[model samples]
Target: MTGESLVYVAWAAQQMNARRDEFIAGLVLVTRSEIRSLDHDSRMVDLLNASITENVVAAIHFLEHGGVEADVEAPTAALVYARALAQRDVALSALIRAYRIGHGRFVDEAMALLAAQAPPEKALPAARELVHRAASWIDTICDRVGITYEQERDRWVSSRSGLRQHWVNELLSGSAVDIVKAEDALDYRLDRNHVAAIMWAEDTVATRDVGDLFDGARSALGEALAASGPSLMVPTDEREARLWWPADRIDCAGVQAALAEREVSVRIAVGDVGYGVDGFRRSLREAERVKVVALSGGPASGRVTCYEIVAPIALMAADVGDLRLFVQRTLGALASDDERSESLRDTLREFLARNGSFSATAKAMFLHRNTIQYRVAQAMDACGVSFDDPDAIASVQIALTACRWMGSSVLRQTNPTP
Candidate 1:
């Protein structure tokens, strides 16, 4: 390419770099057939077109980040661009070649030919020349970059998957329901709680080990997970993202070192040791939250920071025996206010003691089944448990345990506050 052509291509690349959607739309129109079919005004069509545009977007981003150096191997990007601007026949073959050497020029020529539709007889020879040119261009680029096409392809795939999983995993297993819903509406399938984190260069991670991502510290991470733990990495999208392994003894020293950088300045949270996925979820949430709210104030990443926010609830769950006693005694003293709560507790115990059959419990209390249910609901409601959730089961059970230990206090008709 002459200096004039080079300057034009460079300027064109800049335009591509800055206005990705428009550049990619132009790319899609490089060939005659695609040019004829795209609906300029349809979001659905734009979305359909995004599959190709996405690759261009990434390439443009990398180019912008790397500067205008031709030496920067825009590997794995041509195929995306080529496939998106499917102007010629053998699109798939063309895609495959874009990863290899010598194919880059062929792509440029093919795209040029695609832009100019000649009669079939002439088009055939021109297309072949274009392919040859592209293949040669790709070869030169590969040699310049010193990376095999296969290696680039692998890295590209891995990087895209890693980024996607990062987003999905963040939405899943998080308290961000609205975010999750919005993403799901966009057809991003994300099962809850299936993700992990990896340790990359501290604070300087422009992109992940596998991807060219934006600047936000990735919520989905992947790293060399310790083999002895629950699992530090899980398949966020089959490329492997780091997940919280509850049973694993956290490498605090290693983690601290990994996060020791002064820039990103975030903290990691590890969860209780035995609870498997639950613990992982809790710890991951805690760590992520701290990184968001507390990290701004300054705390290092990759270490345990209990987040103290959930301490009371956690402590109560850890040893509800004592908590239950306290709750029961407090309620027993306040019996004057709601005698039905105490009565319900006593009745439920006797009913349960006789066996879990609702009829038996109702019979022992000489109450209707519906009445018994109401009191049970009332008693559960009266307890600190949020009966609407799964967590309440244990809370209510603990309260019962405490009330049962009350000896005569339970049945004394002690004139619990009215």
Candidate 2:
């Protein structure tokens, strides 16, 4: 019976096209008029007329009398009632039933249509995947740079951790510091976005007052920068230590002055807020630069000065030591008006010390590599440091480093740094 019902629906669709509009319209609206009574009076005994439209009427009649077919896509149960709407009812009830039956498949069809409209929907994701790509491009560049990518990564990590360690060790000294797990003891909300200052007082200040400084610093740090965590004081021997400040939330000068009352006079080298790890080097380099300021008055200085202000003067200090000798010995021919001769010697020495690696030497002096190369060749022509000779490069490297203690050059052999 189910198979018979399904076969009838296909027969109905095929036969409907042949039916006359007038005949179909009348059949569809049967409830409005007594079509069956009219047909009976007309003696429509043989409904299977050979005329195409008449055969269609027969098919419609047969469907209306309960003959039907299953919808492959629509629900099987709807087929029973589908014949009731077979004559195109005003309610459009049969179409509505078919829509419900096909609802799930229609949604899948819509998505497929959308996908067809767009081609190759992947660019950013492909770029992101490249992050895991094993290509050696970056590694090659770094190898030529005299530093490995991994080594650079480690250096960056160490600089940041070192800065944190410097503060943690001092702030958490003795019982106050939880050494079992140094990192956990720190209520630290820091990694990147931190800056620091190295503050020192004259040894002349009373030791109790110096202790008062630590107490005062903590109290001040709390009030001034509520957003930042507490300050960490890293002890560097007995003479000095470092203080950590979250740059975004704290003021370096205010903290420095607060310590001045108890410590009497302190030197502070303000460090920059470094990128999580890599940028920390900026802070460390600046801190090291400002140490010259601390050394200006032997760590007892009162003035709060920026390293940039004193960098040029500090650089000239070494020259001042061996300056006349450089002018006399290294630059002896300068009186003959060869201005570049001595300058070129300094350049050559820098190049050789860098192991012929233009990039490394350029970094040490903060110069460009091409400039360093040019200066090296200039220096060789002026002075006599050859690139091919390791012994010559060694001599030059030593000489460049020993520029600080120029007159004591002979003494350097007794205590060589390398």
Candidate 3:
């Protein structure tokens, strides 16, 4: 290297040291844009900030020393940061992107600093050398980070819960395997009556201490199924869990009452009772479907929903666009959002629910028989439906039930009536 180039490198290094905070801040912004996994993860973001600070300090030191060399006293911070991110389940792609972005930003800032501190004639060669050194340094750090990430991931995969999760995933994937061995590995019986459940916290902040939430769910579920025998629970992610218990029959009302008494805010979907291995798998599938319907129904916290009760609504609403069209076509202006229309829709719903008996509908709605008849006539007229047609009555009933389950907010988006 020329004497002039070495002098420029030293001058740039000094300037970087003086403006260390600014360099670190710029690097962090670039890295954040590239590493999307860091979003909404405060702990990971803090670790990344610390890593950037250490990296900036190290870069300044390397520039001042004029070359990169193996240093035993101060280990690279990038490797430590990688381990932390891997432990948090950040993907390898995100890590590589972060490094690439940080390297690019560092080179740009170093070149600008060099140009400002040194003569124009010397800046070009010094900038080239600095780029080479920075690239080499970043490459070495990335390699080390990759190694550390692999080690951490391997360790995590071999852990007990990790093996259980892997086994569950394989079973769910329908891979050809021995069910007996899988059951043995999971330590849960598959050859029995099973009731599947999917549980999750409604609040994101409550998911931070997921272990505590899981424990609470386990205890509550155990109490609810105390008469049913042993149960198995699996943590699916930070925010959700899948569980099942061996029971001759699921007392859904009893389970709902038990969960409602709990202090924790959890939403639970209980599947229909099924027998043996197929039952276990089917129940889980049903539970997952019920979870979607429950979420759409509204606030699910401290609520246990049984699939059997909502199955009709879930089936009809599965094709949402079609269901919305069906509702609009069946109800016409009766599906309007105005208070009068809403009241008429409710009256008609109750009237039809009573099998066209005006007395029964009046008793249910606590209105006079004439009043109930007037509303039903209004609803039928507004909807342009024939009371004599059985299909029309069935369609109107189904649409009303769907709107009740799906809520007004969902219907308002696509309702044909104003």
TM-score: which candidate is best?
Answer: 3
Q: How accurate is candidate 3 locally (lDDT)?
A: 0.75
lDDT score, candidate 1: 0.40
lDDT of 1 by residue, 1-418 (tens): 2333333333334554555555455555442233433322122244335544544454444333433334444445443333232311122443333233112422453345343544554544544543443344445543533333344444533564434444545444555546555344424322333222332222433323433221122321112124332333332221113344322444445444434432343224433333433444555554444333222222221233334432333334333345545555444432322455558777655654665567888887788888877776665555544435645555444445444432232223445347
- Model 2 C-alpha lDDT per residue in residues 221-248, reported as the tens digit of each score: 4454443566656543223456565556
lDDT for each candidate structure: 0.40, 0.41, 0.75
| Candidate 1 off by > 4 Å | 1-122, 139-264, 267-418
Best by lDDT: 3
Candidate 3 structure quality by residue, lDDT tens digits, 1-418? 5766877777787887898898788778767775667652333566788877887787778877776456412245666677666554568878877778877877787799888876777789999878877777777777777888889768756776657766776777676868888889888877778888888776654547777876787677767766366677776545667888887666778788777777567778888888877788888888877766676667722378878877877666555667778888888887765678778988999988888999999988888999999999999999899988998889888888766666553355434556
All candidates: TM-score: 0.25, 0.30, 0.62
Q: Could you list the CA RMSD of all candidates, in the order they appear?
A: 21.3, 35.1, 9.7
Give the range of the ten consecutive residues with the poorest summed lDDT in model 2.
40-49
What total of clashing residue pairs does each candidate reach? 36, 5, 0
